[model samples]
Target: MSTAPLSAPRPSPPMPRRTGRLFALTGAVVGVIYGYDTGSISGALVFLSKDFDLTETEKGLVNSILVFGSILGALIGGKLADALGRRAAMLIVACSYAVFVALSAVAPNVEVLDAVRFLLGVAIGISIVAAPLYVAESTPARIRGASVAAYQVATVVGIVLTYFVNWGLSGGGHWRWMLGLSAIPAALVVIPLLRLPDTPRWYVLKGRTERAVEVMAATDPDADPHAEVAAVRAALTEESGGSVRSLLRKPYARAAVFVVGLGFFCQITGINAVTYYSPQIFEEMGFTGNGQNFLLPSFVELASLVAAVLAILIIDRLGRRVVLLTGIGTMAVMLAVLTVVFSAGKLHGATTWVGFAAILLFTAAFNFGFGSLIWVYASEAFPAQLRSTGASVMLTADLVANLVIAQFFPSLMAKAGAAATFAGLGVLALCALAFAAVTAPETKGRQLEEIQDYWSNGGRWPTAPEPGPVGAGPLGGSAASPASPS
Candidate 1:
């Protein structure tokens, strides 16, 4: 009896290394816009309060309105990314930044400044969703973690750059110049994006097979375009029934919960509370004066940049779970230290430096884990069809948590004291450590398609044998073609 021909396994296609790097660099530019805006506000608020005669409540509102706007942006960003395409969505974000950043520089009143900043937040919301997704989709699995981390690297660089700008201008209080410098970088992002194409997976999802193949060829010359395209199509077929709500159902729900929880906890752990109010926090610790306040926080941001670089170097090697657990644990310890220092009443001499050291170490730990990995996790955690939507949901949670911290942190500190406030954040850090240990998966070296398959296989990592060539039987199983692009 003649046996039917047996199917053979094919090796995974090589990633588009050069093209992936280019896309990653482009995402970094998007990150620069995000970082500059986030950091600029921290210093600008100092001069802004004086210029506007602001109260603590008003300061909180000014700081938080941008985060609130980001919430609105995150809500819409997913749909925009899906409907308009990631490249187009990011282009819109870049243009919006140029306009709003310029407007922020020229605002005649705090109301107008707040309104402009809110609009800028919308752009930020969309870029954060689209940029990392753009890089994650374009990059090869081997270096995908590092490539995505590049966005975080640029983000830290932007923050550090802004801090220096704030310091230079703090001498003269050139808050307008500080906010406006970002417009230059915003305009710069548009140039590279104009030349790039949407991700290959996105093209496949849209059923533009020819374009997808072209992108695959350009990005990964070593890749088998036909094989990769078929794999994507097979993966898309598996996700044909997916929607925003589907993320709350079986398989996908675990990922959604992990990602959303990550987003929420990353913020509530007090990274932004430090980023937004570090100068003020230091001032409260008795390091007063405009130049002196921004000067110390600049070092804090520098430490964060160094930690982000370290994450880029080791994220893939150590895996997401290891890095996250280490970082969160360190953060909890540092926060506990800060609680003790703050409880000693206003810091002086060695105690003051000790408080500074704790803050610096806390931020470094934060950047190493949560800041660097959050985007990588958000971008890679969902099926191709739901990638943007999932990222949006995570970002929305992040911004909402950030809003609470920004809006109520000062009041909380006043009412409960700095020690109590930090103790609360410390508690949250411990909770995050447990949550990450229990829920966060090791995604290093896995292809995005394999990750989706993990979810489809009921919470277990997919270990089924690789199938015959694409269209033979899904990559690992059978499913229908993806739904028509929305």
Candidate 2:
């Protein structure tokens, strides 16, 4: 009997390594959609509350349902993508979110809309984990830091765009328009995912040797796929059992702690708080000159993208710890200045703009360091088999923290005032600096499998592999793909 293609795998074609720009573009689109969906709510809620007769707490509740729902989605999305493949999984996530966002536009009242928004949050969470992990698993290590960073960059872009849309549409009281517009990007994702190949790492893990090869070929056009295929299969099959449970044992535990802790610390710095409430916070601080225009969010996005691009260029050379510590520490200083300015009751007009500039500078520094580095580190800290689960754990913590602050920021700004909030964030940034100084290890210039073994065994350097043939399969691919598994 003749075996079918799935049963009898074909040989992998010659697959060339793609340029960093392709990966960056792919990542940028995904990130921008993520940012837009999440940030659009900031403006959408204004009209939503009026249309639905939502109370202050009710409005917060509706807005926060998304974050709360995303927590579970982020955790599960990683495992789902790892098992089902990043390309397919992402398509599912995008479509699901598009439907949910569309549903949100037709809700009968605040109650139903809040529930739908929560569901949409779940979709957003799925995209967040899947997108970054996919980019990390697919990109080459040389540009992994930046490629994964495409998540942050895209996020800022999405935020900028969403705000622009909200600002434009707000005048017409077209709340539904803002909610409905997200479907465009969701639709945009469907096409790319169809074109995008599965993560090479996923194929190796599934023992789908031949498909893995073909997928890698599609990702890059010139390199021989056979050599890389053999290498990837060897790494997956040869590697030992590594999963979420294994990450907490012995040497790997340190890496886990650092990842989770830093992930926690990153959110605590009030980045999410600011992101979720940028416009509201500005208004509360008496920001008037910017005129609630798209210009503000667009500038923030520009600054963030520039920082992320710069970070992608220098991250490997500077080391993760150095970049994160430097950026967060600098952010703390800015936050301190912001605190003093706000506390002195000099927060309106020019002072507010100066505060906004301080915030933008902090955003740039963050993208240059922490924002860009988090996904890279998460993907790298885990091994071939455990990346998805590991990323899930870290991201769940991130999502939960995001929910907490997003739900509270407006109230915090109102009750505690800008001074206390900025002061509190400065403290969190300080904590992040100290944590990185102590626990983080360097992954600069290292190969993927080597880095895995090192993380699994306390940064023990792996014996360098000889430079093999271009089509040598995955001889050098593991953390090198546009998206790492984690």
Candidate 3:
């Protein structure tokens, strides 16, 4: 309840540098577990379906059940992160992952496996919210994009690695091994997290100024920690509270709409459909055998991994809006080509290669833009006080869109065929592109406090007033170039 102005100078402490990177890297490891859990099922489904004698609907349920759980997890994730702290919430999620993956491996029946995977989804759900938020809060604005993109990079790595694992075990159809080995990575995440402090922003929110300054000094060596703390406090002072309903009012409302829309479009444009059902799609396109199915998707995933790395390299330099618009536009074009190829009838000979190339390019384009930037945007969009609450809302919208695709994609493909499916997704890609063009803000190197100010100032990215003492001006004095028109 202390509302003391941050203008008073605080004691500065010498803390180690690059600790912020450690936090980002640790969050990326969690992304690895998330990716593994998501991709493992893609290869495992073929064998698991045979063993369980699952119908198409049942298979879709098994795939989507995890997303359903994630929706629940995401709904509560904001409160959990806010109350328990990001590091503690992640610890809980990591433990849940280990337990659920183990249960999933030993599940004696399909029903049990579904139940366990749903529980696993809850863990994944919380992670998607916590991991990026942690990285965003802990790292400096200079490398924030790359640092957060590391999570996406790690995600692609996990997917590619899981695909390889699936191919290795496919000879004997060892789906259990594919699903359970992720627990090892999940267990490893606890180590760095145990040593890492909660984000300075979180500390400031709780009114622990001394600790917040200490952590900020360590994480952002270039900035005056006292200034940063003052800015965060200034921004928080302007906000009423971090309630969900508050997001629907004034300055925050536009942000809420943009973030939720971004989250929904990020999923609904058919990335998960390809991710979850690549093998089946390939099989329908005339690829035969588990080896071909799994091997082919591995190549596609590898392209995504390469593109994710590219995102890390260029996101800060090129800015979020350019990457989002260009990547989404490319995806629409690729989907259009895919729709045409599939409509030519079941792929064979030359058309098969064309379809493969289209899918590969589509996946790569997606990873470059939507996959990497989604986290950055989600993490940076809201005021620090409402960061978790806003993220939870966006993530819930995201998972709901994901659930719809995962639950219905199989049936959609079966009833309408690949041509129509690709066509529908292509239209969505177009919509997402237009949405980004209109609404996405360029948050290239702006500090978190500056971003909060952008919302408060009626959507204009605030330019810094004349420089004063390091932390003198309102909202922590730092020169900032105006953002490009959103």
Which candidate tops TM-score?
Answer: 3
Expressed as tens digits, the lDDT of each residue in 1-486 for candidate 3 is 565656975645355797898898889889988999999999888899999999977888889999999998998888889888999989999999888998898889999999999999998889999989999999999999999988999999899988899989999999999899998878878887788889999988888777898899899888899999988877777678889999998778888999999999999998998889988888888888647878898999999999889888899998888878888999999999999999898678999999999999999999999999989988999878899999999989999999989988888888998889999999999999988888888889988877865765566675656556654433443435545455
Each candidate's clash count: 1, 31, 0
lDDT of 2: 0.72
Candidate 1 residue spans exceeding 4 A from truth = 1-17, 466-486
| Root-mean-square deviation per candidate | 7.0, 5.4, 3.8
Candidate 2: regions farther than 4 A off: 1-6, 9-24, 217-231, 238-242, 293-295, 346-350, 460-486
State the RMSD for candidate 3. Answer: 3.8
Give per-residue CA lDDT, model 2, range 30-129, as digits (tens). Answer: 6777778888777788778887777888887877888888887887887788778877778888788678878888888887887888788777777777
The lDDT values for all models are 0.85, 0.72, 0.88
Candidate 1 lDDT, 144-197, residue by residue in tens: 899898899899888888888988898888889988998988888899888788
Report model 3's TM-score to 2 decimal places. 0.93
Which residue runs of candidate 3 sit more than 4 Å off their true CA positions? 1-15, 463-484
| TM-score against truth, every candidate | 0.92, 0.87, 0.93
